[model samples]
Target: MRNWLKIVIFLSICLPLSGTADEKSGDHSKYVRHVEQGFSAIFRGDNQTAISEFETALAIEPDHSEILHYLGMAYAQEQFWNKAADSYQRSLALMPDNIEALYSLGVVYFKLDKWADAVPVLEQVVELSPHHARGQEMLGKTLLKLRRYGDAAPALMEALTLKPQAAGTYQELGTAYLNLKEYTKAIENFQKALAFGPGRYAEPHYGLGMAYLRLGDREKSRAEMQIYQQLQKEFAEYERLARLTRAEPNNLEAWSGLASLLMSQKNYPEAVQVFQRCIELAPNNANFHHGLSRTFMALNYPKHAAEAAEKAVQLMPDQSILYNTLGSAYAMQGKRREALVTFQKAIELDSEQPYYHLNVSKLYQSFGNQKLAQEHYRAYEHLLSEQKAKQK
Candidate 1:
């Protein structure tokens, strides 16, 4: 009877314990698998897939803080601010001391324009990790947004100490000083910002203009304000073009205009990217390839320029401008004979284009063919004179 009781106890305790352990192990494995897949999708910029995988992982491990944080990142990437905030909040609830979650929550609040809400969370972030430059910077900006200039100044100063070359931070700090009626300090910070970004950013110029105006330096203020106005106009146009592209991704005209604008701004790298995107949208369009070639040339990537220009010529053989661009690329690459041939082709396609004749003339000059060079040069001069007469 005792032996029977012992067997019963063993079966009841050991069998159930073994089954529970196996079930837990299986659940853990499944949760990890889903989490891994979620991260992989996020790395590939597939936020929807990442969100789905993270949601599945969350279902399996409902209280996992790290998983919640990752889900928040995917949501943030999709610009679902509220959803991202909720995920971060939930993650922080499970791990209240998590500095990353706190910082992320603060950033989301800032994005949502919840300046009041962002303050305490960012405060917590800095409190937990005093050396976190980005957290300090965001906190300072949030404080500035709230118009707490006094509090913002020191925070921003600390941020600057951590990251001395931050142009935006300098701009924000200058604004803080301007609000505090410290015109000289504001000017100094604004100048520092301009030193970093120059013509690429507008806010520092505007702030400098304001500070100069306060100091009764009307001449300097006017100059600075004029530049600010021009920069603002360019920024507005950029925003308009950006919105158009977002609204109509396949609009070749919009893409081309944006790429052209970037090139005009001397943002060669960004122009290259936009031109590449234009090519992706319309692979057979020679203009996009030509634009890319020009951008690559501006960047001094002669090999890349040659390749892109070659593609453009192949796509639109009859286009004289494509041949001219290819010739320019070949010239840059020291392929003098190829460049001469290509430039001659451009002139043959459109004899009225003075630049084509000019290019061929230069190539002939390089080859010591003085007679041909002078002949082409005269043709270039004649065509240019005709163009000028038409303009008149």
Candidate 2:
């Protein structure tokens, strides 16, 4: 479920702590000091300390909506979800139109997987904060989870208009369209989500496959399903290896396996972190350097990618795939000559490899060398055919 419901627990220390006129209670100065300490504790990630301080503030100003809201935030940070919900409810009772209390309550309901309970609260949030992108997104996601496809679509569309590159919103919107049998719209949204390179999200591809199938495009459907299945397997492997890494932080193999799977899943940021762990564990490992290079390339950090690729090449000069990756990195950096030379080396080392021949062919075509391009293209085609024949 695309992290759509994460309620940040940053309490507003700057909020004026003037006791509400409705709450004819304790010393306003004490209430303000307690609130300040509570928010400071929340900022420090000390949820228990924050909870204690907020409780003291609540004791001083029993009917204070702001204090109640911050108390709920502290409870939420501690995963005392039911307590958080109750506090938010109390705050909302005091300030019926409070957007923060409504949104946080909706998020707490979502964290509890109470989709039914989340809808109305989230709807109120969006109604109150019409321009709030995340409020719209959460409403859409909640509706999607409830399989309210028709209602989900418009909310998701609004969210997309607010933040076009929100991949999760796109994924949920695609699923909504797919369920509603709007194949073309489903396909378009699914393709958009995938274009953002969310390889960890297998469901969007599955939705694409279903949409294509509904459109009577069996070949395209099957292709999408294949990708979905591969990503599913890789995601599972990543989770498994992640557990192993956590259990054995010093385990180089575990880190390497996790990094490789993350790379395959297109989680380039996490992949880079895990690959960096592997490098720290075994600095001279060519495979780790290669993985780092690939992840950097995926992240569009071409300079970093080229540097990592160079290290991989130096570590394993005989590896054709390393040279091919290096070539691609060079190409990404617009070093056409170096790219061509590296691609040629890869082809020389692996003459029958279709990818190497295809890369060289594309490079030749880019340079307007029609004859060389045609020759390499034919070679690529021949190799691909031979491989397919062998598979048959």
Candidate 3:
């Protein structure tokens, strides 16, 4: 319970029959030994070794329910949810009443985000093993994901009854209460979760903030939101130094980090402001100009984007990406001649860039240059086909 990551529910296997000296075929003891080794591997977090040992056990007894279940647990440990689901399905086919297999299969489906599939399998788990806290918790979480707040509330409450100290259960129940518009209950559960859970857990803080807002406690809501933001700022690697940028305005790295974080969060206008500040400090930084151009384009200010992109191109004439951005900005502004020349320049710099060819093809098509359009279009198709083949 202390290590939440130790969540996999593994199937326990019995050793081979003691008096099987004369009834053995191809060494049944060896299969049992491999299963034991697989179990050891799983305990040590060596999932690949566990997979191999389980696979060896399966080779001896292909229809083995226990071996299939062990292999599924190994796959689940490796985050191979699809393979884990398949292995559990095979195990279930051999032994339908196997609670371990049912629970594992449901957990795998949950991992795959197949909430509908998970619901029935997990429902059966709680039905058979009514006091199974983990099963109840998973079912509650899945139902919450599916927006079945009414059903989730009961299951989460039952899970809390089964495991009174579980912070995650409290957090999930808080979410359910929030969705049901029980603001007081939501705030209570969220506070309980924050009290018991790790300090870095941001979700409960966010939930508490929402609950406070709903209750018209604006000051408390703002306080909780500030805590949530501070937690997020600490957890995100790139955004860690964002606040430092305000104190040390000349720190280009801090400003760049903040700008990148804003850009990734799609706060394009804020990112543009940050990049402008960065450019003011370091005018020759080509990447900053390029970032500003991209942010401007994201904001659909093509003319401003073109000016910023042209500066980036001027600073780094050989960079294909700057030309591509400049060309796209030109195309957006209906400067067909300039866009065609720039797109062609980008292709000449890096013919392997598929987008450059695609843009040129579009530009040609716009001007009725049928021959050039066909040539570039064929090139773009060929590059895309090659990329797909490489992926395979």
Candidate 4:
């Protein structure tokens, strides 16, 4: 259950499965004593010591599968996956039918990118309990990642039927539909996902927003974006921005932060309006022009983006990002020559941004300028390699 729920549900990160020995939580008395020790240690913040106590119980009752499982779970709570996986594996060895161990091991394998190992174990779980919603759901997601969309569909569908209320299952089904280009079905599932997992979930709504945008439902896309905005706001953030701007009404950074928050909330029209107001508040401010230009782009008013971009460039001739923004606006308007010139100017201004290079490469590729595109691709690759080397 943890494995099936953790992988697809948490997206590469697994939440801890620390079993509680709470007296009111379980029935096994002797097992409960050790579990309580582990729980107490964990709660008291002596996790490593708590882990040892759980390990000792497993040793005293060498055949106690439950003790082994909880010990593994304790290790997992501390993010010691290798130890956790080993404990789960030992539990499985003792009790081959241990679903918890199987599930947890699956998550560990997935986290380690041991997809091959994960697939067989999860498949076994699904086969053992064909109607288990979580098992089917996890197998479906794993299959999707393996690009077996056709095979993934039936399992995901079955999982949805059993767990109709699991928003994440719907999201996965939507992803499967998306990969298959089953747009109508994808949208349907996505909407269901929104109903289930919409609040505070970044990816589901981001996916739905993109899907609506693809279907030319701009208003729906904006609506989904509004939820993302609502979830992202914190009291601290609002207070921080307010303080940062209190003494600097004309501060470009502060104004940009406020503008960004408003934009995320899908107040695009207001964001555009506020940015225009900001530009007037500080007419010669390059950032205000930049902020206004982005707002116009979000509003899908490309012509306005172009004008704002032009103003930003005029004010900050050395800012490559501003030129890139303007170039995008020009490209959207099909002003090919202007886009090209501005893109070139942006590269001359800032030679390090791979995106700037990639943008120009894409434009050239669209125009069938294979030679120019290849040059830029090579440059981008070189930069990427250098960055990776630095990280090492």
User: Residues 288-364, candidate 3, lDDT per residue (tens digit)?
Assistant: 99999999999999999999999999999999999999999999999999999999999999998777899999999
Give lDDT for model 2.
0.89
- TM-scores for all candidates: the values are 0.82, 0.65, 0.55, 0.48
On TM-score, the leading prediction is 1
Ranking by TM-score: 1, 2, 3, 4
Q: Model 2, range 260-374, lDDT digits (tens) per residue?
A: 6666566789889998899999989998899899899999998899999999999999999999999999999999999999999998888989989999999999999999999
lDDT of each: 0.94, 0.89, 0.91, 0.80
Q: Which portions of model 3 show Cα errors greater than 4 Å? A: 1-24, 238-392
**Root-mean-square deviation per candidate:** 3.7, 12.9, 23.2, 23.4
Per-residue lDDT, model 4, residue 67, is 72
Query: How many backbone clashes are present in model 1?
Result: 0
Q: In candidate 2, residue 105 scores what lDDT? A: 95
Better lDDT candidate (1, 2): 1
For model 4, residues 238-315, the per-residue Cα lDDT tens digits are: 457667767777776776677777676666776786687677778998988898888888888999999999999999
